[model samples]
Target: MFYWRRVGRIWPVHLVALPLGIYAFYVAAKVDIDWPGLISSVFLVQTWFPDVTPTLPGNPVTWTLSVELLFYALFPLVAPFADRMRTRWLMVATAVGLFGMYLVNWVADATLDPTMARWVMRHPLVYLPEFLLGMTMALALRRGWRLPLHPVVPLAGLFGWTYLYYQERWPFSDVVEHQMEFAMRPMVGVLSALIILAFLQREARGHRGILNNRLLVSLGLWSYSFYLVHHAISRLATYEFGRMPDNNAVLFTLIGMAVVINVICWALFTYVEEPAEKWWRKHTPKRWLDRGGETGGSALPPAPRREAETAPAPV
Candidate 1:
């Protein structure tokens, strides 16, 4: 079910986006693109290779799909084992994994060439710890763990970190700064988990506020389609018209562009992503879901199947 639903939800928008994006690159403008990179992008495995991706060919941002695809494939396998572990052990393992994530980048930066370092640090496997952190958090919460936290803390910390990084105000030695740079992604994952945990705990306690707004929820449903095309649209804009002058005025241009892109997001989500996913769900073979039944050729054990049922959004 997870695999079936994820494919149905993502592939429709991808099929539409990739060709249009390719045309935008190759036809609308005569930009030179690598065929190998383009092929990898089509299969959404571009990020697995060095030269091919993290340089996304057909659509400039589909490299993320490559990363997420790895997660989708591995999550079900690891999840069964993860579920059997104690919540405390699960969280400890996730923390260790995140530490390993940092260590991998630190080692790569120290030993590898710049190009290889980038590839190593960004390989889809490097991101598995972040996924584990999220998974651990969910399991911990389900097991009734909670800590007193305010949503603003994570948000403010993220803002402060961004300000420090952008302003170069870290007040650290160059070596320390390098390590901090290496640490950013793993650190961001922690902050993001905290932000999610804060809100989920609040909601668990029956709190409700602006986050529950219907408008926001509606926008969330359309968010994946928005993600799919926003980059290509901006890239096309940059191709057609050079970057806006560096000034405060660009912010308003951004706001206007966002409104226009979101209009397309609505149509793409309504006409393509939603309908295709519904059709796939309605038509997918029961054996594919493996309902832990006679029909499935290799059915999952009922215990594991019960723990791994949610169909997470493709994003």
Candidate 2:
């Protein structure tokens, strides 16, 4: 939601992040240890330096931002192609091509021992498939692809993810140690596609399942902000309280903190994100062409056309 809105009006989302960024910096600075490493990690500048800790609040998740940035840069170009090729075959081809690329890369990495393969995986080229999966699902629905609603898909996805996390021991376990884990990434993509398709199809049929509720929609709206700041919030909370000894106590405390922080972040998102977006649309120099053949100053162009417009104009 925030990504779409940001693409529509970039400046507002940047403005919204200012305070959050400041808060992150403030917290990091007040901490008693390793201010330089924290600063480098938080801003993702540590990626350039060798000695910096690889794992930090902001370092690990910065790849997602890179992926989002790539989307923002390429969306304008792909939007037209995606709009034109609205066939199920096109979607399938794209999905296959993306996965094929990953397979090729994985094979090459194994053969040549490319030290940078992990970094390459973090690149936007790799994860674009996941976002493309979502977009294709949306287009599939627009073309009347019916979604299967049996609980089997979601249940399978849940169990599969849990098993991958526990059995494979993520991050530490290599592809050689656990080929199943590496293979399951694409399956996770498939599962996510199914879940998204189900929700969209339900909404199209005017049947609200769980996501259509006002509160859930609101949470969805705020989910971006929550994702961005939740780690920092969690770290701060944990730091303030010190580490709990009991496993159950620690788990419960973390869960409670997550809930409280998510609520607060949601409120901030609604107030800061929405209003700032509106303000940007009003003031920004960008212009968007509307579907009604009119010009609007909004940042997002109209949604893609569902059907061909003029039958190729007789060539």
Candidate 3:
């Protein structure tokens, strides 16, 4: 059910977007996609064999989803072991995971070609450590570990550091620079977990932030669709508009594009993602695959049956 639910949630959107992505690439990059690469994409295992062909034949951004699919496949196996670790060990494991990613960065930097190195950075195995860090943080949080800083402060710090990293303002050795290129994924994952926990802590104490507000929450529901289609929309825009006239033109174009993308995302999310998820869960039997309660389906409990409603009254 966990697998099916994931398939149900993403597959429909991906299927619809796949051709659009191909068209976008053809428009923007003017490259004819290889069939083998597209096959890997269809199976959601493109990143596993990036040496053979481009993992992103349909959409470059969907490469991340390939890594995510691997994580999803491994979650059930990983979760039990992760849950059993003590908080101290979980914290230790988190540190180990971060360090491991740095090691992968160094190794890949030393060995692989630039193209293969880029692929290595996106590879699922290379990202296991990052995934492990998230697992560790989650377990520690479940065990009641609180972050030292407030959510907003750390969140702001994260963005600041990210900006500095991209600007090459951060000090870097060759290995560190190579690592740093994709290191943001794990680093951001850690910061994001902290922010989530801090927000949960605050909300528990009856405090709220703008993030908890309704309009943003409504938009968050469409985030998945936005993610799937945003690149396509942006690429199409780029294909149409050869280059920007100026900074102001760039800004205006981006703002206009964002508005159009969100409108389309809203429709796709409302009509495709939500309905597909509901239909799959409703038609499928409960506990079809595993005994675990987390099938990524609706969290609501089954409604209680009223005795008289199922039977006719005495006539």
Among the numbered candidates, top lDDT falls to 1
Residue pairs of candidate 2 with colliding backbone atoms:
8-300
Q: Estimate each model's TM-score.
A: 0.88, 0.71, 0.85
Q: Count the backbone clashes (under 3 Å) in each candidate.
A: 0, 1, 0
How would you encode candidate 1's per-residue C-alpha lDDT over 172-223 as one tens digit per residue? 7899889888889999999989998889888987989568999898889889
Model 3, which residues run further than 4 Å from truth?
A: 168-179, 286-315
Query: How do all the candidates rank in terms of TM-score, highest first?
Result: 1, 3, 2
- TM-score top scorer: 1
Give RMSD to native, each candidate: 5.4, 6.5, 9.4
Candidate 1 clashing pairs, residues 3+ apart or interchain: none
Better of 1 and 2 by TM-score: 1
lDDT of 3 by residue, 134-206 (tens): 7766555445555555787878978886887878645778656755665676678777777787787677558
Of the two candidates 2 and 3, the one with more favorable lDDT, higher being better, is 3
Against the true structure, candidate 2 reaches a TM-score of 0.71
Ranking 1 against 3 by TM-score, winner: 1
lDDT of 2 by residue, 210-303 (tens): 7767988877887767766676566565567766676666787778887897787777677776777676555444333233223333333444
Residue 231 displacement (Å), model 3: 0.9
Model 3: colliding residue pairs: none
